[model samples]
Structure formats: C-alpha cells, structure tokens
Target: MSDSEKQCCAPKRSRAGRPPDPAKDQAIMKAARDLFLERGFSGTTIEEIAANASVSKVTVYKRFCDKETLFEKCVRKEIGRMAEAFDVGDGSSEGLEQRLNAFGLKLTKFLTRPNHVALDRVMGQEFAQVPSLGKRMFEAGPGQSRARLAAVLQEACDDGILTCDDPLRAAEDLLVLWRGFIEVELKFAVRPAIDEESVRERVEHGTRTFLRAYQR
Candidate 1:
C-alpha cells in the first residue's frame, strides 16, 4: 500500500489505558471560567488556572491546546448549560403560554446568577479586545438561543396559533420582555440579585404581555 493508504488503514489508537477524569475536567473548567470572569481574559493566565484547578500546567495543556482554546471551551460549557432552557417543548400538547413562561423563568434565573452576570461583563470586555472571540461566543450562545426561539415562534405561526409576521423579531421581543433591564441592574449592583418569586412574576407577566401582542 502507498504511504497515504497505509496511514489511513493503520489501526486506530486505543484510549483504553486510562479514561479522562470528568471531575478533573470540571474542576479545570470551573477554575478557568471563574478566573476569566474575575480578571478579564487578558488578565488571566494558564498558570493561574492550573494553580486554581489544583492541576499542573501540563495537565491543563493536555486537555486544552492553549489558553485561548481553554477559554473557548469554558465559555461553551457555561453557555451550553444555559442553552438547555431554550428547549421549550414542541408546540403540540403544551400551550405556548406555558412553554414561554417556563422558558422565561429558567432563562431569567440562569442569566441573573452572579457567575453569569460576571460572564457577561467579561464577554463584553473580551469582545472589545477580540471581536472574533465575541462573535464566536455570541453565535454559540445567545445567537443560537434566539434561533431556537424563532423556530418555536415560526412553528406557532404556521399552526395559526400566533400572528407573528417575523419570527426572529418576535423572538427578540419576547426575550426582551423576559429579561427587561434586570441585567443592567445586576451588573451595576443598583438592584439586588432577583429572587425566585421575582423571576416567576417577571416571567409570567412577560409571557402574558407577549401573547397579548402576538396571539392570533
């Protein structure tokens, strides 16, 4: 066989000697994310992450190619957790209002968390410094959530349940309703972190108001 063919046909390497430790991975990710949030991306260092994670620099590098890659992974991990809230059920059995209320509540709680608020600040700073990183993070996180929400709105419109002419715009409107100006308040510490009752009340009001505007 030619060198290329032989290389392609070679036995795949087995990763059986020792499995990667999920605990260690989680520790590293948590450490890196917290550090990034506390001290903007430019201020954070791989050595600091390793020290905080209680792992060696070699261990950090083994899992992530470099600090940039590690930062990206950390961002994705945090956003991925938040993205779960966007999976409002298929618009079949559940009423759209119920789904929207549920989604709003979950999203509000996630976004208002201290860590998440800090993340938004760090993300903004990073975006100013490295637009590409910001773009990628937005695409992976909020952009995707908006698209998912738009999909739900479009489905409702197709079913004649809502009268949305523009699903994306409607989605944006609904999200704004749910979020309001809470993030700004939290970021500036002008208002305390929202409690669960406040979140529920906000979400319920937002869902009702959204339906009033969009319901067919």
Candidate 2:
C-alpha cells in the first residue's frame, strides 16, 4: 500500500523523502512506536527513530522535544488506535447489554493481541522509572478514551437503559474489568493461546456482569 495508506500495524520502514509527505509523520511515529515497544523508554533514541523511519534528525526534533516526547506520541497513537477500534455506538436504540457486548468483544480482541500486551508491559516498566511518563500516557490513552466511554454510559443512564449513580466511575470499572479479563495471562515472552471463542466467552461474561450491576 501507499505510504499515506500504510497499515498502522506494520513495522517501521525506511522511506521518507524531501518536500516531506505528511505520510512521513506517520512513518516517524510508527518507527518510534515499534522501537519503544521493543526497547522500552531508555533504550530508544531520536537517531534510531530517524534512521528507522528514514527521516532526518531535524525532522524528528521538529516534531518532538526528545525521546520522551516521541514515546508519549507513540503511546497516544496506539491508544488512539484502540479507541478507534471500539464503536461505542452513538446513542444506539439497542439494549445496553447488546451494545456493551460488542464493545467488550472489540476491546478484548485488541488488548489480548501479543504485541499490544507487550507494549503495555513496556509502558508499565517505564512508568515506574518516570512517573510523569505514566501520567502522560494515561491522559492520552485510557484517560481520554474513558471520558468518551463515560459520556456514553451517562447517555445510557439518561435513556433509562441503565442505572448508574456515577457514570464515570461505572465506565472506569468497565474498562478495568475489560482490561483485567484480556490481560490475565499476558507476560513477557510468554504468549498463551487465546482463541476467538474464548475471547467472546470472556467478553460475554464481562458484559453480562457489567449489565447486571447497572441495568435498570
């Protein structure tokens, strides 16, 4: 595929030319993301990102302050992808369980991916050394996405499909449950089998529990 339409899931490449296609920005971020996940926070560098992305150091520095900034951008980009994966339907007429089941399934599928789990582990390890990095990651990733989910939960409550005293907390709880379910067995260099049927079963169970707690 063309650079502009390159798959977001692909590994880094080396092709960014002058007159710089906006696609180069994606290339840079993609490179940074792959490196960060593979090497962790301190292990990555701007020179590496530039070389991997086939862009100039000046190009990388122009967009990010340092390695930290690039790492943050990568986290944001990945989380943005996760958020985009969930439909979280806009005020659908469907029952709360139906909508949540779909959301849970998509979320589980994304989180259970081996690469995604590895990325999360890297972020977790980095966060221990750099607290602010974790904060930035939360704000950009789960923090922003949770707000969107909270809004949807509030809408559901208002529509009388659910009974949540604090929609934000409820949304957060759902996210926690979803993450816990999918990440239960994920560990570095240890990827256990997670079939489609198992994922759907887990999503169904989680969605059912969430609904039971909130259903009106």
Candidate 3:
C-alpha cells in the first residue's frame, strides 16, 4: 500500500467529552421552578424539566439524584432570595427603626409575588405527601433567614438601639409580629386580597409595633 493510503486508513480518534456547563444547572433549576409552580409537585416530571431546560435526562440526573432533589433545589433557590431580603441591610447611617421598616417592606414585596404564592400553595399541599420537603424548605429558607435576622437584631442591641438578651428569640418574635399569619392569609387568597398597598400598610403597622416592643 502507498504511504498516503496507509496514513488515510488509520483509525480516527473519538472526540473527548465536553466539560459540564455550570449555566445548565441554573437553567434546569429555573425551568424546574416554573414547571413546579404551573403543574404542582405531582403533575411535573423529570422529562418535562429536561426538555424545558434544553438539557438531557442524563445531564439533569447527573446533578440531581431524583425528581424530589431537583424540586427541593428549585424551592431552596427562591427561599434563598426570601431569606436574603429578611436578613436586612447593614446601614449605619439609617436609624434602627428605619432599617427595620425597610426590611419589613422588602420582605413583604419579595414574598407577595404571584410565583411565591404559587410556591407556598404547592408546597403546602404537597408537604404532607413528601415528608422531607417541608424540613428541607425550612432549613434552606426560613431557618437561615431567622438566623440572619437574629444577627441584625444583635447588631441593633450592640448599637444600644434595642435591648435584647436573646437575639434569636427576639428575631423570631419580630418576624411573627411583623408577618406571621399575614403571609398565610395572603397566600391562601383571603377576602379583599393582599395587594401592595395593603401589604405596605400592614408592614408599616408591624414595624411600628415591633419598634415599640424592642426600641430603647
């Protein structure tokens, strides 16, 4: 055989596997969130999530062991946003009351979204059926948020703006006093609805009430 013919007959090397894209994980989680909100937990499927995210089933499965894990990831992401808002800001120039008032309104605005309402309803309905879901959601979202709020409260105590021996207890009480059942009422579609105006009004009232209890 000619040398050129022998060279041409050499076996071609297989292509190396493509590196995993980090953005695909975000896409999968975003798609999963939309589907979960629209279809509820039982109605959604991994195949739909894969198609919606423009990723393969193997890709999805590689990141998440099961549909339940994927669902938790989506919920946790939103919950993180919620907790971020509740953690409040570190503004030395602003008065403690002002910071708290802003924080309350910020948290209200974040939680009162249509998608948030949908998530609450879906999670509430399915929490019983999926035992670990509630715990995961709590730990990832509310629990962390409580700790963050506690930190802010402790800062206020150090500043002498508030007198709180146990910041955790104070934070929990503040949350309950500010939001509490209002979230449940808003999520469940209580009469007259929980509009922006009403929510803000409630937040204002709660802030005032909380300041009275905690402020120096």
lDDT tens per residue, model 3, 1-216: 233322312223336755556788889999998898777777888789999999877667767766777776765676556545534445442456666666676677667667667767767767787668778767766786677778878988888878888999998887777676776876767843567787778777887787788878
Model 2 scores what on Cα lDDT? 0.71
Q: Would you list the clashing residue pairs of candidate 1?
A: none
The TM-score ranking, best first, is 2, 1, 3
Ranking by lDDT: 1, 3, 2
User: What is the Cα-based lDDT of residue 50 in candidate 3?
Assistant: 90
Question: Please, what are the lDDT tens digits per residue for candidate 2 over residues 1-216?
Answer: 233322233233346633546787899998988887677667787788899999877667665656666777776676566555346555544555666667667667867777667667766777888898789877876787777678778888888888889988999888776666447567644547588788888777777778788877
Worst window of 10 by summed lDDT in candidate 3: 1-10
Task: Put down candidate 1 lDDT per residue, 7-45, tens digits, no spaces.
Answer: 212123347855667787789899998888777677888
Each prediction's RMSD to truth: 6.3, 7.5, 9.9
Using lDDT, give the best candidate's number. 1
For model 3 the TM-score comes to: 0.76
Q: Which of 1 and 3 is the better model by lDDT? A: 1
